[model samples]
Target chain A: MDFNIFLETSISIAIAACISCMIKICTVTLNMKSKLDSDYFILKNKLILAKKENSILVNKVVLCNEINSKLLQSFFEVVKQLLSLQKFIFEKGQ
Target chain B: MKKKLLSFAFLFLTSFCFSQDHSKIIDSLKTVIFKKPSDSIKIKAYGDLCWYYRTESIDSAFKYGNLALKLSKETSNQVGEAQAYNDIGILHYNLADYKKALKYYDASLKIRSVLKDTMGIAALYSKIGLIHQNTFKLDSAIFYATKALKIYEEKNHTRYIAYIKSNIANIYRGLKQYQKALETHLEIADVNKSINDNLGLTRTYNNIANAYLFLKDTVQSEAYYLKSIDLALKYNYKKELAGLYNNYGGILHDMKKYLEAIDYNTKSLKLREELKDSYGITSTSLHLAGLYLDLGDFNKARNYLYEGLNLSKSFNINELKMDAYDKLASYYAFKRIPDSVLYYRQLFKSINDTIYNSRITKEIAEVQEKYNSAEREKEIQTQRAEIAEKELKLNRKNTQIIGLVTLALLLFLLGYLLYNQQKLRNKQLQKESELRQALVEIETHNKLQEQRLRISRDLHDNIGAQLTFIISSIENLQYGFKITNNKLKGKLTDISAFTKETINELRDTIWAMNKNEITLEDLQARISNFIDKANISASNSNFRFNMDEALSKELVFTSVRGMNIYRIIQEAVNNAIKYADASNIEIHIKKKYEAVVFTISDNGIGFDINEIEAGNGLSNMKKRANDMDATIIYKSQIRKGTKIILSV
Candidate 1:
């Protein structure tokens, strides 16, 4: 009877250990979910900041495009005037 | 150009708003929002409004904080949301709603971590540290303060670093590490001075003073207190001034300077009231009341005690109320007002008991909450185990049922087989016993027949020889003597014939007794021989024997029946030859239905069977036929012929 009790105690301890191991595994899985949530939120914030930065950059690019167009038109006007003056001087010299 | 000017104007206005009173700043922020400024500008205004209202009105602060949060979410402003959460946390902290403060702070911390807002994160860390410090969690306070300090130091934010260091020093002081607390405070003071943070410097100095007081160095404490006072007054640091005055009053109270203690305590209370520091008011009120009570000014003590009591009730501060009650009891006793003293004493007892019970209850509730959470988890585990155990038990039961059924079937089959085997064995044994009995009976009958045959053969051999001898002697006597007398010769001849007849009968008896059964063929052969003999004896007569061809060769008769039938046939033939004096005789044996018919006829002198009395020969023949279970008839005729018929 004493031996039977000892065997029962040993088996109970083994089962408890197995249960504890499974519980630990589940807890680790839950902790991983929490970590992933944290990472997701962090990435989301980063994405939002990136979007804001992108918007600012887009605005600057549009402004620069306008400036570039204006500068090209001015350069073309100057070139047309120079070409005409050169043509007039060449014709008069001829 | 207009946008830049507007932004500049907004910054100027915001800077101006920070220096104004709470109501004015709130009004300015309202106007800014009313003007339909850009969403960003409006969000900023809301955030500022929340911070300004935090100490003055918690509800208004929460309202604006929520507005800021909503606007920021609408605009997708992560930084604005983080600032809103921080402002709300501060408001709760100032209102002494530490639990709500911690929750909001944690929310802010998460956002700030997400936004990578280092400065905001550091500032939140310090605030959280202060909450922990207030709750007497020194280890947690130190942890958070150290985290903030590390970040601030990395960013080269000297002012923030100094502020965090000062908080850490306060925790160290709470832990009773006065030397470490004083060293950290002194170091933070240098950093605060370097950054020209007069408010931070003053706070650091006040912390150092408290540390010195804890160390029992009154001179150093007094010097540090004076330095902190100078900086606090110069910078108009109302909060720090109130705290410094309270601490200085406590030191004076401890030093037995009653008047000084009362004056300092009163100043601290007035400043706390002006600043709306409800917690500070309760503390300084109790101190002033107790000091006045010690000075024997009953009215002043009573007034201050009542003020402290009312403030403690308003703020729900039990420690302050407990102190106020105690001081009131002492004051009434000093005045020799017995009834008033007793009343105050009872009041003091009641309040003390209430505070003690509330503390104990709060502690128990916290422990119970933890225990309940653990029990809930354990209950879930136990339920899972129980389900598994039940499943196992169910499976075991099913297996046991199957095992029991199989065992029963096997037992039933075995029982049936055994019963069938036993029945077969009993039948076999009964047959063997019957066979053995039959064999024994056959053996006994064979032995008895052998004994009977031996006895009959011996009698035939011996009796036949003796009869033959008698006949021979009689014949010899008659021949050899040649007797002249006729009667003597006749007698000798009769004796020889009689002996011859007896020998024939003896032979017949031996034939019948020696065999168990006889065939009809044997009887016929015996009867045919008798007829031949009769023919020879009667020289003037001829004999004929007839048998049915249809009589089966396999037909048999028992010994007794054969003997009886043979004798009946022999007697009939003899009677015909002897009595009838027949010239020729015929005998016939025929089957008629299941019976045999025997007939003999003679052509000789005949007599009527009715006229003649039955002699021994005829009677013996009839008797022999009866023993064979056969019917016999004798017939005779005169003149024409004599015919005898026997039917059996």
Candidate 2:
């Protein structure tokens, strides 16, 4: 009986807390909407600035990939030329 | 004594017309209406004229009021239009045209509601209440008066609350709830006093006196009547004075004071005529006739009875007309004229029966009005409940959407972190493999270089000495001997030159076999040495190399893998010089997310990756990168430049 009473009280407190949180979340969320459009997750200026930084990072990645590939291609050409040169030298020496 | 009473009565009754001549005001207002300064001003001036001529000339009042209504509508001044309609309703109400009065009041009410003019709405409701009161629709009267009182109370329009409450008190009196009427009137009296509204208090006093009269407290009734009369006379409220005098005369008539009743009724009738209070005039005329009959003056009685009947017929006052017929029957019966009495009695019965039927019809209407009002109240409650339910549901929906969105956001963040972690682990593995491969290459190169060094030493210490001796003997034979074949000498010279060239070639082969394990510092030094060589060869070009601060200088790698990296770097630098016409070149190695990233870039004319990637240009590089478990990405555009990133 004591356990039952305690459980009931605990359940009531939990329900009360849920209701309070719902109300507070609504208030905070609505306050956020008052400043920003619904589609966005952040302030206009902050989102724009974040996007700008992301764009720069993307450009850097693209440029890096291009440079790396160009470098690797040059190295492969040198290796191909060296192998061909070695085959000629071995054949001619024999 | 008669002259004194008449003079005093005249003085008090002289209020509306005597305060100022209404004709002069009407004429001036007429001129103002013609000279249209502003339509709103003209509408107001016309409304004033309507009020001024309401009691004086009913026809002129309606004409000017309609003009005001027309002008207000034309200018789209809804407030002025509402006021005009209210004035017109009052004019109709004064003439006892209840149907027209109610219609105009409804029109004004619609406008006031649209405008959200609560004060104007309350006033129209009070006026409608008065119309219902006059028409004897007591239920509707109380309903409208209560509605008006509630609005007035809500708005804290205290003075107007007393007015509506006074009207409600009168409705209670009509309902024969005399005690309730008396209580309401008493409260209203106090409210009027607090506001210093002497005229409003007088109306309350009159209602209280009537309630007392109905409750059989004649002394109390007379006392309240006198109190009301004193205030009415002081304020010269002619309509209120008229009502008070008639009611006081009723008390006097009951007390058998025929002469005093005649005096009060005379004053009431005179004032009623002045105010054009049609119902008041009809009632007072009948009462005065009854008074004259009580005085045993047949001539005066007959004359007043005829006057009352004519006015009642003209105004369609059927209830008072019946009373007039009854009184005529009594007058004829007192004259001992059987035929006249019979005629009047028939008239009375017919009119009374007609009134009874009309009263039944009116009662049906009143009941329907009450039922409709209740149904309207019920419908409003249902709508209110529905609206509240909708709002609660909407709020819950918003809460749920927010909850789901937050949950989704948390899930997405978790997913992103897991993916990033997997990527980091993969990069780490690839970097380790790349370094391990470099270690393998460096070890293999070292072993091969050791074999080459041993072979070269063997050639230099043993076979080179034998070759040197052979060469010297051949030289001695060619120099000491006198005669020799030219072909044989040339062959010997060819052998010496070939031996010397073979040794030089061996030295070159030994030079190509070099390092064992490579460190980060060694790689940097090697790259710098290569760049220095390139700069000397391609003097106009510049090269730069950068290493991450977090990368250790002593980080070691295998010979073959280091050799591969070195060869790739050399190949890339050579290509940049040979093909790219680039002015500057840069190589950057950094630790990113626990993975080592190598970026090779140049400010040169770039190539299209779409045109480049489809070719077999990167096949060997890709194969080497796959062996090391390293990933390489190449990006380039024409004139933008080329960049390559290797992550391991």
Candidate 3:
């Protein structure tokens, strides 16, 4: 009788272990899926930020270059007038 | 007119005086500049020439700078224009025309400031300051120098700071503020010492020597000059060496060591010639000429002075022209050529009046204001970069916080699931243990039930055998002795009959106890055996037992209920046999509505059931029917058959 009880206990434990393993497998699969979803969302957000930064940098560069272009234009205008004046001075001196 | 045309030719071929390969490059550029259909390329070629000739030949550098500037304006190439102006300014500065140098420098400074080119603006500030210092405009020089200093300080450009500081020190020396000049030079020397900038250190030493010389500290001046010379030679700072030799020669001249001064000036001139520093050659030649004049060598003196004059005229350098004119006027006077002396004197005065205009000071002030605004713009850019970096860090921190929270929640959920699983496992174990206990209790009850049946069977068997023996011994005594007493014999016979009945009751108990259940067939078989014995004992009457076809097979009953049903049938049969005087007796068994029906009838004279008291046999049969939960009926008539029916 004791042996029978031991055998029954062993079988029960085996069955319980199988059930536990199945539950563990389900939990693990759910955890993995959740982790993947979390990581995917985080990465997607990071990609968006990177794209935003890239666009911002490009805009800033364009703006800077545009301003420089305008500045250079004004500077050259002044230089042209100065050169013409110098030419008149040289001609008068001759 | 011939001199102007010759100067133009020399400016165009300045590369020829430098590297032969560079001359080829310049030739190609000149061809491209004239022939290329693209105005942009023409401008670039012009700019290239200006850059190549800036150091080698000042007049060529000026011509190219002007050409590039003109083409850049035609093409609207602002970068080329800015570069051309800067190059032209440097060329004129080298040519010793401080007024023209400041004009070109301001133009370049305006463009660079508008472009927010911080380094370029700072460099232009230094150049403009140098021009002002050259013209002896001390206050205007300090303003531009300080403007450049602020920009370099904001940019943290250490090397450029030291260079600008050296220039400021030179300006201080020109102001005769010896204390301020020495302090600025020391500051520059400390920076150079920290960064190991040997070239900057050599220049600082030279400035310190000049400062000491102006203060009349000859010992300190000579020691610093030697230090400057030693470093310049070791590092091969040829440009600094040339300037140092000229300055040292001036000190020698002040000391009235005319031969030594001439030797140093000649050495300086040789180095300038080797370096192709046309401005240095002109200035040093003028110095050598004056030294020879002081020493009474008129032929050598005129040779040096005229060479200096011709070179200065070719380059259009006003500073060198002024010095050459002064020396020539003195020489011509010494030689008694009054007409040449008056012409050179008038020329010097005309150039001086042209260079000293205050419009130049106003322009320098305007350029300084432009640089200040550009500096503010650069500061805004730095602030924007810092804000962007902070935002990026904040974004990273937010992501880290979200990741950590997700991890913590996941861990919590995992822990909850594990805890639930453990609880379920413990509950299942408890249920299994309870099931095991129930099975043990059931097994124990089954064993006790089996023991009870065995004891009942043993008691029934032993009691039945003893009762049978008593009946048989009573019969044997009655037959063998032949007793004559009727009452005693009758009583003995009654006792034997009682023992036989007791034996039958014991057998029924044993049968019911030995089996958990008894079949209707066993009850039927026992009834038939009693009928057979009754026929043998009472041969005068006939008895017949009949059963229905449904009762041919065994009908099941519980052991206790079967015994009760059998006893009821046996009593009915016995009562019919003893009380009825009939020729025939019949007992019939049938199944009716799931109950067993038994009928016993005798063909004989019978007493009325209502007239007689209830007999022990009849009452016992009713009691046994009640025990079996069955029904019994009896009917009899005078000279008619009697019948009893039992249904269970």
lDDT of 2 by residue, B1-648 (tens): 644544443334333434566777667556554544466667777788788888787888898899889999999999999999999999988888889999999999999999999989999999999998977788789889988888999989999988887888788788878899899899989989999988888988898888888999999999999999999999778889999999999999998988998999999999998887888999999999999998999999999999999999998888888899899999999999999999989998998888888788877886899799999999999999999999987876676565656555655655565565556556655655555555555555555544544554554445445555655665786688853556555655655555544433323222222344567787788778778877997998888989988998877655445544655566566667877778998988888886677777887888887776543335655655665677878778898877877776
Q: What TM value does the first chain of each candidate achieve?
A: 0.64, 0.44, 0.57
User: What are the DockQ scores of the candidates, in order?
Assistant: 0.00, 0.02, 0.00
**Which residue pairs come into collision in candidate 1?**
none
**RMSD of candidates 1 onward, in order:** 48.1, 20.1, 39.5
The C-alpha interface RMSD of every prediction is 70.8, 18.7, 56.3
Worst 10 residues of 2 chain B by lDDT: B504-513
Best by DockQ: 2
Which candidate achieves the best TM-score against the true structure? 2
Candidate 1 chain B — worst ten consecutive residues by lDDT sum? B448-457
Identify the superior model by TM-score, candidate 1 or candidate 2.
2
Winner on lDDT between 2 and 3 is 2
List the candidates' TM-scores in order. 0.47, 0.50, 0.40
Query: Which digits, one per residue and each the tens of the lDDT, describe model 3 over residues B1-648?
Result: 544544445445554534455557677667655544366556666777887765456578778889889988887887788888988888777767677778888898888878888889889998888888877777878898899999999999999899988888898788778989999898999999999999999999999998999889877888888899899999777778999989889888888899888888888888888767888998899999999888889899999999998998897777788888888889888889999899889877777766554356656766787787788788888889999988977876675555556555655666666666566555545554555454455445445544544444454455455556656766787888886667557656666665555555555555555555567787788778878888887788898988988665568766656666777767766666777777798888898887788888888878788888987888978887786677888888877978888888
Please give the lDDT score at residue B68 for candidate 2: 88
**TM-scores of chain B, in order:** 0.53, 0.55, 0.45
